[model samples]
Target: MKKTFEVSDRLFELYHRVHRLVNESMTEEGVSLARSKFLFFLSKLGPCRSTDIACALNFAPRTVTEAIDGLERDRLVMRKPDPEDRRAKIVSITETGRVVLEAAEHPRKQLLEEIFSALDDEELDALFDIVGKLVDRTDEIRKRKDEAEEAAQIAIAR
Candidate 1:
């Protein structure tokens, strides 16, 4: 139990360390890591509504709105009235956004490469497997929780 806790603690710390490093490097290049995710999504998906970005990114609507506002202010993205729904707006990445995103990606990729280069082939393979297992277990837990909630809702309805 102690070993398990120690391993998880180290993993958590390592995640934050890497995240901080990546964010710092990207920020120097004019795009914070958090904002890059939104740009990446918009670049791929083209124009979509705030609701869609919220759902796809698993972010709260208000959080998405704030991020979009910042991105728009920076000229990284633009929002226009939805043609189909006057009450809602559609957000899309600007050409400038694409250029900035591409530029920022280089440093992010290079930093990750430099960090991962420390691991040899065997370590890389083992780390990949471990991460895959952890992700699978997390997904399994989420599914079970969702099922349990549905069951509880059904019982309450009766």
Candidate 2:
């Protein structure tokens, strides 16, 4: 019997393939996939706290810290104490980071275009719409789970 594949299975495989492609494309910049993502986020959001970065990026705090450390070492980002919260630090992209991010934009766009070149405009639109709905639902579920966990912790503390 011929094995059949589900849409989810295909999507999972495609995700990994795209991820690998991106990572490979980024090699010349000496930026890891994770750090590149963080740089993009910082470029979009401007200065932000590490906690915010972790939450927004859905990355662990340690992961964010490590990425920040690497970026800082590369002079791509800088960390400074938050004025309102002494305990928290704010991270901002450096000039070099901005330059790197700008340089990366075209190639990243090309890579994405190449990967999805098989899909025509209508197919791409439909795929994006369906994926957007799935992403929204996933975010909703995650938010509910986080709220429930927080409530449980509060109840326990009380």
Candidate 3:
């Protein structure tokens, strides 16, 4: 019998390949994939606490902190005290960061186009639909897990 793989196994392989290609392409911008992620998140979220970035990215606190340190050093992001919380610092993207982000987008677009060029429009549409469904399923799973954790905590407290 011919070896067969589950869709999830094939999807994981595809994820690794795409992630490797993206990281390799991002290096041309003089920023690692991780740093680019932090820059983009700061751009979207505006000034926010470092912990918030860590949570949003689902990255370890140390990882986010180290990336932020490099970003701050490169002047792509700046740290300031949060107005609402004196003890917390917020990170915001700088003008340099905006320029870097804009410069990065064109090449990223080209890379994605090259990667996806093998698929026809119909195939691409089907792939998108499946990916969207997977994302929704993951979100649902996360919600259930969160609710279970919260209920457990409440039960323990009582």
Best candidate, lDDT-wise?
1
Q: Which portions of model 2 show Cα errors greater than 4 Å?
A: 1-5, 143-158
The models' CA-based lDDT, in order, is: 0.97, 0.87, 0.86
Worst 10 residues of 3 by lDDT: 1-10
lDDT of 2 at 22: 84
Candidate 3 lDDT, tens digit per residue, 1-158? Answer: 23335766787898889878877777787666667888888888788889999999899998888888888999999999989999989899999998888777677778899989999999999999988988999999999999999999999999
RMSD of each: 0.9, 3.2, 2.5
- The residue-by-residue lDDT of candidate 2 on 1-158, one tens digit each, is 23335777888998999988887777555665667889999999999999999999889999889889989999999999999999989999999998887777667778998989999999999999999998999999999999999999999999
> RMSD in angstroms, candidate 2?
3.2
| Model 3 segments more than 4 A misplaced | 1-5
Candidate 1, residues 77-106, lDDT tens digits: the string is: 999999999999999999999999998999
Q: TM-score: which is higher, 1 or 2? A: 1
Clashing pairs in 1: none
Worst lDDT 10-window in candidate 1 = 21-30
Q: Distance (Å) between predicted and true CA of 130, model 3?
A: 1.0
Q: Candidate 2: worst 10 consecutive residues by lDDT?
A: 1-10
